[model samples]
Target: MDMTPLLLAEIQFLASFSFLALFMALALALSWMLLFFKLRVRLTGDAGWTAAYRFWVRIFALCFALALAACLPVLAQLGSLWGGLMDKIGNVAGPLLGYAVLSVFVLKSCFLGVMLFGQRRVSDTVHTLSVFMVALGLLLATAWMAAVHSWMQTPDGVAMVDGRYQVYDWFQVIFNPSFGWSLSLTVLGAALAASFLIMGVTALQALRRPPGDGERCAFKTALIVAVLASLLQALAASGMGDVISRYQPVKAATLAGYWHSGDEPELILLGWPDAATQTNRVLLAIHDTGGRWLGHDSKGYLGLDKFTGPRPPVALSFWLLRVSALLALMMSVASVLTLMRTLRRRMDLAALGLFWRKVLVGMSFSGSLLVVLGWCVSLVGLLPYAVNRSINLSDVFSQATSSTLLLSIAGYTALYVVLIAAFLGMLLHAVRYGVVPVRKTTGGAA
Candidate 1:
């Protein structure tokens, strides 16, 4: 008698939420370097801007701590929850994961300590260097994680040995075709999320009272960076879609509720996908642009109707993609308009009107929402296959019993609720109380 792996939707959703928390921290950590470097150059004539640097460093430390805490459970889930997948692929993923933890996390946490505590102890030069190091660590860590996911999706550079997937080329596993584009999108998404969050915080402050020069400066910086990131995201979105259309046409077709194959197919812009009926009712669509949009001679491209396999829910993925893309574009437009207004006012919030202030407050979470949406589109889109063509979800999922799963779900749910509450509570408390006053340095000290 042999036990079989059982795919649990609940477990998958839980794992996704765990990753969401980790990514939120990653975005904050990655964005700190941009904020620091940008502020350093823009806030000229302050002898390395020591006053401003100190203010941002405290905020960075708080975010770093939260991110570190959120990631612990996600790592534990690999062994405890998804034991079946780990039993098979642990020999391969374990080493890659260990290297990332040892190299990236250690480097980041060590430097983060220096940035937080060594401001007065170490020289300003060392502290500034630590900031850059922490940022580098974040990027590298993100890259490693992306590589792991990419390998999972494509499953190249591995061979089946004695009924198990084994890595033959370590370099190939980390350098998959999707690695570069995935990392780029992740970085840009982080920038977008971090920028909006900072802007939102400052905007909330502005609403409480007329913004001071520092507040105005922060708003301007965040808005400008966010707008730039949005533009880049727009530029990257098409290329990413094209890659999916070419490499994973099933996902591309599902994204647009595209079912039947046709020449010069229209791109469905707005529609309600009815998976049961295998049809979509449309309100808007582009005409005869599939070939031009997806690739050269897009008429030659495949469709979801042609795919013969067990697939994920279609309506959910389609709606998610539409919402995420639309929200992203809307934010881009809003950011650009806000940037123009800030520039016209000479970076003074007093000159900024009330209407835009309200709008900014409402739109502060736009980037974070986009981050969550994009993750949904990607992860849900790659369903049924834990390792693309190699490992089906039915073969890689956990084999926990009903009673065990019930207890696990209940326990994890409680734990998740507590962790999320604590994280948000701390963040809110910090925002409400943690105001670092900028003091003029006697001799260029933070």
Candidate 2:
């Protein structure tokens, strides 16, 4: 299909929100984890824990602010760029959107303020409560949006009422078939991203400051979290892929390039899927897990061949799946080894050599990349139809004007670049300047 005006609009909107959501999810995850640590430290009354908490709070605040700023435009674009989609599903989505903005966002922002500034203003218990509330608000906000996406993927309990979709049962909409798996993947991905970010920031701090007890504490925490999250991420991803296999066969098939639905479907770990020829040239093929991977039947499995309609871009989906899996495995090994070395008492946080420290720094963004790749696979795998077998891209954006489409795309791209750069620049400044100067007399946080 050519790049039509509506298609351009769709791409621009997806790109903008995808970038924003990745960082925001990370922030939400970090916010909760940090707050939990902060609560523990408050009770322990350890200066090391206090310093670490203070330092991370700064980074969390930065991500929260940037993510919030980027989110506004996407919300606006839902109406401006894709009004037709809203118009079709307005009755259902409108209420959810309202709740997110008015209830969740409002509560999140209010509690975040308390978490950040209430340390001195409120009692210790109240401050901790504020942190808990902020985390809860963020979680609820994400859940609401995830519900919307789940409905789109596996729409149920909705019917046409006066030519507009009406919710017959809200429970089905919220707890759709894909809801649990999608939420699990999202939460795990967020944790994965946040852990990497924490590791990255702490590593940078090590470059400027002598390893104080607080710095060591933070580094240890980040390392432990990253390692655990990576392992969990691997499992979560497999479960998520399995969910797709059961609910969305076409997407599942495209993911593994399992084009022909038959017994013993070949699992293509690496390949170039050529759709015109309906053949995937495999680099590594495995038949052992094909049936278990895609189905429970005695036969290998049923997948793409079960569907007669047009399939999504198998090459694109396959490539994304492999790349994501590669990054995930790389992070998993790096994290596990690092943890093992620490656990064996072979290497202390302060004693990690420059080589390993640099490696950790490079892998700090792996979580973000992993999540982005997963999103690409899912979104692309649901191709040809924006709302799965029903509503489509062309149907929604047919009214878009071709003349201004390119301009809109450029506008979103340029702004997102600036937003992302600002986010990174903030982190860079924090890394350079946020470290407390070590003193034997008194080691206060920066």
Candidate 3:
């Protein structure tokens, strides 16, 4: 197979997946936030909570719709661009994919309408329950998808028979070694991202008008969630390193920038991995920390040279890991600082200075940015193999012509660009108009 076409196909799939992941994260987080707002409305009957729900629901609806739309290309690509992957692992992949689709369809079709449009017609408790069901559906869908991808990263409970993987234990396959960490990280990342978006939007709204009760409630909630999620995400990330070291040492070494096997592996804080020379250039590192972090402890780990098989791209994985870590640190710091200020000063949106507000707006999408980079690190670190040590990507890539692959890539790119632009434009318009006034009936129904 020509590398040109194969690379193009990989790029195409990645492009589609990135778009899907972004909206999926937002949708999942927003669904739960919507539930929270509805629960508050039910418990307190505050019109402010009603206003918050009404405003945020529109954003959630847009995100959920885009997420659903994004799934189409990704699913299509499995059969169209990487049919061999399904051919080899269809026994494992098929059921997971079906479960994800079924969960989304059943939850959305059955309850999403009632949650979004039937709020007035139904009782408050019923509406709140419907919102819970919708959120549960999103959670299940994310778990199934994460299971499938995590299995690819660290395949388990499957035996290779005549060049194809066959599942023997469903539980082992679904709860693979990395599934827990992967799911936790993904969910936390989504929550953190959505929280920042809320903070930024709330701040923006505050700047435009006198800070309302709804804005203050949203800002406070987002700040608290962001603080918790970022801390949890960091811990989950550290634990994930142990999994990578245990199952994929080469990837671990690549991320740690360990070029040579030694008793003491230094943690490269800042450096350029020069593969040609097999050494880090302009190095700034902490000696012995890498060994501990990679779970080697006293026992030294294998370097790139020690791996007999093909190795992942060292520079790509190294820098992506570094950049993502930096981004996560920034998010953590910002969230913690903002949170401290709120606690000490009882700061509302109006009390937040102009500089801080602009900063919030700028960092609103930081969580989404981290999510994309984290995905890149995981996928790139698994280079040369489509399913751990079992299937090579070369074997799975479709034997399409380069020109054809390029054309499809162009088409997908254009479509996503337009869709993203439209989403942002509409989101901005919603923000500009601020919250829609909630009307109350004579019977005290919103």
TM-score of each: 0.87, 0.91, 0.96
Which candidate achieves the best TM-score against the true structure?
Answer: 3
User: Taking the tens digit of each residue's C-alpha lDDT, what string does model 2 give over 35-127?
Assistant: 767776766777777777777787788877877787788887777776678877887788887776665567666887778765666666676
Off by over 4 Å in 1: 1-31, 34-52, 291-299, 401-424, 434-443
TM-score of 2: 0.91
- Model 3's number of clashes is 0
Q: For all candidates, what are the clash counts?
A: 1, 1, 0
Query: Which lDDT value does model 2 have at 63?
Result: 79
Clashing pairs in 2: 264-300
Candidate 2 runs further than 4 Å off:
295-300, 346-348, 401-403, 435-446
Candidate 3 lDDT by residue in tens digits, 214-237: 888778778888999999998999
lDDT of 1 by residue, 90-188 (tens): 666777777667656676658867766665677667767777777777766667777877777656678888768788888888887666667677777
Better of 1 and 2 by TM-score: 2
Choose the strongest candidate by lDDT: 3
| Selected candidate, larger lDDT, 2 vs 3 | 3
The TM-score, computed over Cα atoms with residue i paired to residue i, of candidate 3 is: 0.96
